[model samples]
Target: MKGDPSPKTETHKITGLILAGGQSRRMGQDKAGLIYRSRSLLDRATDLLRHLPVGDIVVLGREDTKYGVRDTEPHLGPARAIRNWLRRQDKPMNLLVIPVDMPELGREQLYELLAHEKGAYFHDLYLPFYVRAAKASAVHASTERMRDLISAFDLTELPVPVHWRTALMNINTPDDLRALEERQLG
Candidate 1:
């Protein structure tokens, strides 16, 4: 459960992780590189992380020369991808994980997740998680689903406000992207 309503301070030293290594099977193209509001999804995700108090940010599932940490295996799904990445870490720190396809996610939403002292995610959502790296070994689930991973950690679930629901929209297909664009424009 969430211990305090206070915001996490700069001294907390959180590492931001952008999960962008999906195969984009439904989108038919790399969703990470997809353009939205004139910026790539990866860039948008990175920019959102940069605005937070995180100490460092890493982009997983990509091979960029900067900030990118390639997964040992491609298309491992979000849970396994995260697990693999966490296993390579040298020290323990809080991790803020977000997906590249969530183009509508904002810093305000992310701040809400970070407000929890322990591991937490929005109710009914798996991405945009605040996980304690020290507890990585506690996730022993054999399933690769993110929901199972979250449950294994016993992370608190913060209620998402009605207005912020759209912020959780994940653009997995071209139609989804078009719908988001229309909603944004309309």
Candidate 2:
């Protein structure tokens, strides 16, 4: 069910997806379940996204209860997971895809991405994407072979201003999380 669009709406009237199926080799634990400020990393991300201009939020993970999260894995890797999300979505073909490991995302950063780019792409391991869901989904679906799909598609990077770059940082290892936690504490 679609609601009337309003400036007060936190999320766009688009699909909001979180990538959370990583094996977490470096962390040696489920990154999505990590705690920050007393909340699970995924929980914090979900709270942030709730205030965005998005509609539905879907989480793609490897198993239904691996991290005790509401959303489970649809498949492995971002491309495969998103393909599943796109298949399930019945709304407009636009989506805001963020990672589960990014616990520090803020509204200002989200609005900035929405304002400047028709879509957003990440060069790093984990970052949010604002995109035309159909086109992005098509590209993701076409890939079954292990390839550098982002480079293959020639998707352009939506330049995030310097100040907002830190907001996109993702937790790939325990050391990375420790650093981020220190940064947050400091």
> Top model by lDDT, which number?
1
| TM-score of every model versus the real structure | 0.91, 0.74
lDDT of 1 at 161: 87
lDDT (Cα, tens digit) per residue for candidate 2, span 1-186 = 122233433344566677787788788998888888899988887777777677766666734643322232433667666655555655546666788887777777666545533454645533565655345444555664223444433444655567766687877888888898898779
**What clash count does candidate 2 reach?**
11
Tell me how far candidate 2 lies from the true structure as C-alpha RMSD in angstroms: 5.4
Query: What is the model-wide C-alpha lDDT for candidate 1?
Result: 0.83
Candidate 1 lDDT over 1-186, as tens digits, reads: 343225544534788999989999999999989999999999999999888778888999888737998888789799988877776777777888999999999888887777776778998889888876545576663748888878877788998889998899899999999999999999
